[model samples]
Target: MKRYLFIMSLIALLGACAKKEGKFDRADGTAAITVASLENHLKILASDAFMGRMPFTEGEQKTIAYLQEQFKNLGLESGNGSSYLQEVPMVEITTTAAPVMEVKSAKKKFTLEGLKDYVIWTQRTDPTTEVKDTELVFAGFGIVAPEYNWNDYEGLDVKDKVVVVLVNDPGFGAEDVSLFKGNTMTYYGRWTYKFEEAARQGARGILIIHDDVPAGYGFWVVQNSWNASKLYLDTRGKDLYFSAFTGWVSQPAAKKLFEEAGIDWASTVSAARKPGFKAVPMKLSITTSLVVKAKYDKSHNVIGKITGAKQPDEYIIYSTHWDHLGIGKPDEKGDTIYNGALDNASGTAGMLELIKAFKNMENKPNRTVVFLAVTAEEQGLYGSEYYAQNPVYPREKTVANINMDGINPYGRMKDIVVVGIGQSDLEDYLDAEAKAVGRYTSPEPNPVAGYYFRSDHFNFAKVGIPALYTNTGIDHHEKGADYGKQLQDEYVSKYYHKPSDEYDTSRWNLEGAAEDLQLLFNVGKKLAFETSWPQWKKGSEFKSTREQYMPKVN
Candidate 1:
């Protein structure tokens, strides 16, 4: 009997030592993040049969059902108690704007063609959204950040007026790195923020002057979105405020507005960038109307989780938006459904790969791992916003958020791009894992583009969570950086937000995506086992928000 007891104790010791989570496997598929696994998932998710995976349609029904089935098959517990679906109340608004938007200055008058010179949309459920000769105020960047000592609407009463704002923040082209995030764009710079601030300041309407370089994408992206039906979180009971019209104007149209006001375009641009710049009324008014048709519905955010072996209450999250632009205006090839293959299908696939990687491990994590596939990212991140506002897990106990937006379809990269690099300590975890595999971390080249605040991860970041969002590196291992840049540029110009964004096996090689996923999996793997919590960096905008919930010991 004593001999038997000793043998059992010896066997238990060996098993415990063998289950070390610090192996830090360097090989790509060693952690189950293989190229084959990614391709197989992407093929089905990006297939036309999914009908572009739009919310409130058959596509959403099929997509969510598939994810739920996959979750059950993978042996993951339903993240929401006893169910994977978290119902999101939504309202779809389709706005039809008048073709010609008449602009009248005190001295002169002009008319700009809609869908070309400008595009307008409304979020209100009201049948008619009309702005009749609303005064235009050029609120420089339309920011009201007390930290930067900047408030463009300070001396100006823009109530019931249309505020025309620049697309980016002040530090976009500034020589000084001290100015608001320097060249890196902040939350203040986002067009969504501009509209929000305008509404907060009692403005009835607002128009953003769209410049291609600062706006990231071309005017066609705006035209594509506003011209189509839009989805917003249903806030019927709450007193929600939206401008009469949230719109964008072409550069030429904005220049014409300034010229008509006798406000020198060059001088206004110069003054806008300065620290003490104030709001200027263009002495012009915009006249346009929108016929709005809104309908209420429910969308589901499919969620799954692997409970922790030790600290079950503490959680780490992996997120992706499982949605794209659905059937819309046909392209030249007569394709109406926007596949969104590279935009998000790849990302959703990658998130699944991470979950599989975690599930395959013999040694379960110390903290819980939550896998969230959200809805309606293309319609302005409503799904994630819903989750952030109504999380299944407590925000204080949730450790970090690792988000995948789009994975690299090109082959292996020499480095990985870290968007919003200095925001959190989560990047440090990623850097360590990336270095283990002999690759390097690179900061995003276009910091002023504001890629950080554009995606679902931004929703998590907004509420004090330290979120990590990385992209495929530009420096290709075999092909040069120029070649990588060319491929990316082509996709942005040709396929981004278009029906042509289908999964092309001919153009895509998931080797790079596999490596990137392996790295991300390793980061989450480390976080899951360790007790250390990743925090927002000292100077990060989210740092204070985080500190409110998680105070530092020191």
Candidate 2:
């Protein structure tokens, strides 16, 4: 009897050990992240052989092929009807330099170089466009916000005239906290909105004065972008609305324009802030013409979906921008390819991994999981904007959008930066998942730069869907925050918006990346199963939109 009991006890002990091992095994119902798999994807996506993955180029074809192949292998269904690619209509606008941009003031005249001190471009469909001697009006901020009861163009007729405006808004310089959040930029401050509003007001031309802090990047960024071929959605379907000429003026050039009008440039800006401010006529006129060739082409937004068994209609989305700055002028090293490895390729790879993990799960999620790699994000979130406007899944059914833009190539940090914090309950999900891996959430380091409005996720947020755009934490384990800041500074100064942003495995540490991916997965899994739909926190601009679409749960 004693011998029999000993044998049974030994067998039981062995069984317990096997169960423990199985609990931790990724292939056996465990949540294990394969960093090697992620690295392999990034290496291929960011490779020089990929030719920088620019839209409308050879690189775009290669990149899309690889993505489709991976999705097929992973067993995800095509998101579009009978296809993985969603065709997006685009118009490539290539403008040639006119003789010069002639500016005539009361007593002086100035000629601005085409691509040197100033860069001008337009999106109007007109083949032959000219702004001949339009009056210049200095409109402070050039914003009209019903919420704030502020309008710079309240009583001015800006039709067929040039509107010169500040880069950000009056809220940026306001002293009170209740006024536009005091220095935190709202959507009205974005350059896109500025130009769109100007077009709505029937302006002949719109010129924004560039300031480094407010515009986020330096004047060099704008110069580089304007020098390259610009792309926009075809105006054939939608009405094309824009000023005849839309561009930027450097600080000194703007000051010169103001000085030519015999107006104190600094004092005039100060005076424009008060109530009942009128448009200041600089007594100046801008004369410019453009010879533009319009070519309509089709781009794509790649989408793959894993349909849920119980709740096939409800969905959680994982998105990243696949497009980067296409081939452009060579850099100092004579390399014309902008690899955009960290800028977005890393984030794209992360989304691929998340898709794989969801596909591998034994107990399938309750809601469908959608992975979208959008095009033309580098051009200003155009692809995602189009998706938001025309969604494959209903906006009311989209539970949440987890967007990854620039992932950390460096090692792990303590706190992950959450852009547009305090906007949604999605942060609660992220906080719990991150704590599981000894990580925490933090707000954006530079809120004043308006990083929240700079990415594709902003489009979804605009339509009332709760969106989370989180970057790798900054408090590194080895080098701490200072070291992390150093890496960021290097990227911003040297490779950002340049051709040197190619991938290098020697410097990249994807451990932190894998951690963040796991955290995002956990968030999606929770949302997929939960009964309640996540809502924007009170006071958020998207709150009303969310309330309108969310299902009434009694």
Candidate 3:
């Protein structure tokens, strides 16, 4: 009997030592990711049958079911207490444009054609949204940041007025590192923020002047993206605090308006950067009409979990947005489905692939890992926003979030792009994993684009959870940097958000995506087992929120 007990003790010791060695410390790549498997998943999720996976549509039902099935197949438990789905109520608004925006200046009148000179939409739930000759005030930058002691609306009541604002902030133009985090675009620089701030300031409408350098993309991107049906979380009669109209104008249109007002465009741009800059009334009124068709319904956030062996309540989240633009206006070739293959179907597949990797582990993690596929990312990140507000897991017990969106489909990269690189200690974790694969981590080439605030991870970050958002590197291993840049530029011009975004197996290199998935997996794997909570870097906007919500280590 004593001999039998000794043998059992010996077996237990070996198991404990094996666990310490790390179940994820395998050199074989198959355990983490595989190219063929990833490609197979992508083919189905981004196929035409999915119909672009639009929220509140049949595509959404198919997407949610497929995700749930994938999770169940992987043997992962439902994240939301025996239910893999979290219902998110949403409102869809399709605004029909009037083709022309009539501007009545004090001197004369001019008309700007839609899809050519400007694009307009409305967030208000009202069926008819019309701005009839509303006063146009050139609210320089339209920012009211007290940290910089700058208020463009000072002594200017923009209530019932249309505020024409510049895209991005003055710091980006001046390259003054002392002002507004230098060339790095802050939340204030985002167009979404501008519209929200305008609403808060009681503005009837907000129009952003689009310049390539400041807006990071061409006017065509704005035109194509805005000329569609938009989705938002249903406020359920709650005050949404949104402007009647939020839109953009071409640089030429903006210049024409400024010229008509006798305000030198160049001088106004320079003066807008100066301290104590005040709002200038352009003596112009914008007139436009919008007819909106609205629908309210419930969407789902598919959540699955690998509950921790020790701390079941504490969680580390892996997220990807699943919904895309759906079927929209047909392109010149008659292709109407916006198969968001790379935009997000790739990310969602990455989440599932990573979950499979974790499930294959010999030893379970100490903290829970939540694999969440959210909806309505194309419609302003509403799905993730709902999850953050009504989280199944308390924010205090949440450890970190690793988000994958628009990963590399080209080829293996020499480096990885870290979006908002200096935001948190999560960078160190990712850097370590990336280096293991002989790849270096670099900050995103275009920090001024504000790509950080544009993804699902931002919603998690906003609630003070440390989140990591990165993309596949721009420097391809064989094609080199110029080739990488050319591919990216081509996508932005020809494919992004268009029906051309459909998946083409011949054009893709799955090995690169597999590499990214492995790197992200390593980051989350380390966080799940480690006893420490990663914190936002000093001076980060979300740092205080982390300090507030994270459980005290006393």
**On residues 418-495, what C-alpha lDDT tens digit does candidate 2 reach at each position?**
887777999988987778767888887776777778898898998999999887677888888767767877888887
The residue-by-residue lDDT of candidate 1 on 7-119, one tens digit each, is 99999888875774434344423467788879988999999999999998999998998899888887899999999999999998888888898889777778999988998
Best by lDDT: 1
Worst 10 residues of 3 by lDDT: 21-30
Kindly give the stretch of ten consecutive residues in candidate 2 with the minimal lDDT sum: 21-30
Ordered from best to worst lDDT, the candidate numbers read 1, 3, 2
lDDT of 3 by residue, 1-554 (tens): 99999999999989876774444453432365788778888889999999999988899999999999999999999998889999999887898878898889777888988878888888777778888989898999998776577788899888889999999987886768768778899877888878888999989998899999878888987977765767788887676577888889889988998998888999887888888887888888888888888888999999999888777788999999999988988999999999999989999888888998888776787789999999988888999999998999988889899998887988888888899988999999989988887988888887888889999999999899999999878888987875666788888888899999978967888888888888888888888777788888865757767777556755
The list of candidate 1 runs beyond 4 A from truth reads 1-30, 98-117, 132-134, 155-157, 216-226, 251-265, 282-288, 328-337, 480-482
List the candidates' TM-scores in order.
0.88, 0.87, 0.86
Score candidate 2 by lDDT: 0.81
Model 1 vs. true fold: TM: 0.88
Superposition-based RMSD of candidate 2 using all C-alpha atoms, in angstroms? 6.3
Identify the candidate with maximal TM-score.
1
**In candidate 1, how many clashes are counted?**
0
Decide which is better by lDDT, 1 or 3. Answer: 1
Itemize residue pairs with steric clashes in candidate 2. Answer: none
Per-prediction RMSD in angstroms? 3.5, 6.3, 3.9
